[model samples]
Target: MLNIRCPYCEEDRPEIEFRNAGEAHIARPDEPDRVDDRQWADFLYTRDNPKGWHAERWRHVHGCGRFFNAVRHSVDDRILLTYKAGEPKPDIERMLREREA
Candidate 1:
């Protein structure tokens, strides 16, 4: 059982409390119509599939009913960072300010 932190709920929840969404931060082309077939294919099919740390989008289903971001170490499934949805990632220095503010 993995331990997950839900930024919206502000609670340390179990992995069961959330659902694993696909790769986070997928950016679409600025001009969809201008994109060629090859470009579109690459964009749809290619993924980083990193071996080290990775950031993913997770949906907190059992908690605050919101989505958040998590930076986790892929090798051992160690969570490195978590932050609110659509907001910038949390920094140790600024995260404290976020908590205080």
Candidate 2:
């Protein structure tokens, strides 16, 4: 069974205790009224489906019930790390280099 570490809980738990919340770091428009319909639609619906390392939001639904972010490998389904929400996004390039060393 796949285990996910909940940054908020500070422990690894079974994957079933968590839920993928979708792509991370998505920011809302500062002026929603100024954006056209197409822009609004794009913000609501558009997401990247990259084949490699991807940053994503996840929730520890059955544990802390809090949300966090994780860097995961989309192809191999490996979660490299998890961090609390509102933190700055980690440098993926540096992390991958360190991992390969």
Candidate 3:
């Protein structure tokens, strides 16, 4: 079972209590109506599907009912860390390299 920490709740909870909301940090078009159809479609439907470490958004649906950011290792399904929506992303890869050095 996976344990996810909710930044808002400040505690770890079972994965069942949360819902993976897919890739995070996507930027919205400044002028949506002016964008080409293909661009608009891409924004709405396209998302990162990486094989390695990835950053994603998750909703604590059964708990705080708030959304948070989480960096997870895709291959192992291991969550590296979680943080508030507006908080800066942590450099987990750099930290890992440092640890291995």
lDDT tens string, model 2, 1-101?
67899988889899999999999999999999999999999899999999999999999988889999999999999989999999999999998899899
Report the Cα lDDT for residue 58, model 3: 97
Evaluate residue 38 in candidate 1 and report its C-alpha lDDT on the 0 to 100 scale: 93
Native-to-model Cα distance after best TM-score fit, residue 87 in candidate 1, in Å = 2.7
Report residue 86 deviation for candidate 1 (angstroms): 2.0
**Global fold similarity of model 1 (TM-score):** 0.78
Score every model by TM-score: 0.78, 0.95, 0.89
Question: Cα lDDT of model 1 overall?
Answer: 0.80
Better of 2 and 3 by TM-score: 2
Q: What is the Å distance of residue 7 in model 3 from its true position?
A: 0.5
- State which candidate has the highest lDDT: 2
1 versus 2: better lDDT goes to? 2
**What's each prediction's clash count?**
0, 0, 0
Question: How big is the positional error of residue 64 in model 2, measured in Å on the Cα after superposition?
Answer: 0.7
lDDT of all predictions: 0.80, 0.94, 0.91
lDDT comparing candidate 2 with the true structure: 0.94
Per-candidate RMSD vs. true structure? 4.9, 0.9, 1.5
Best by TM-score: 2
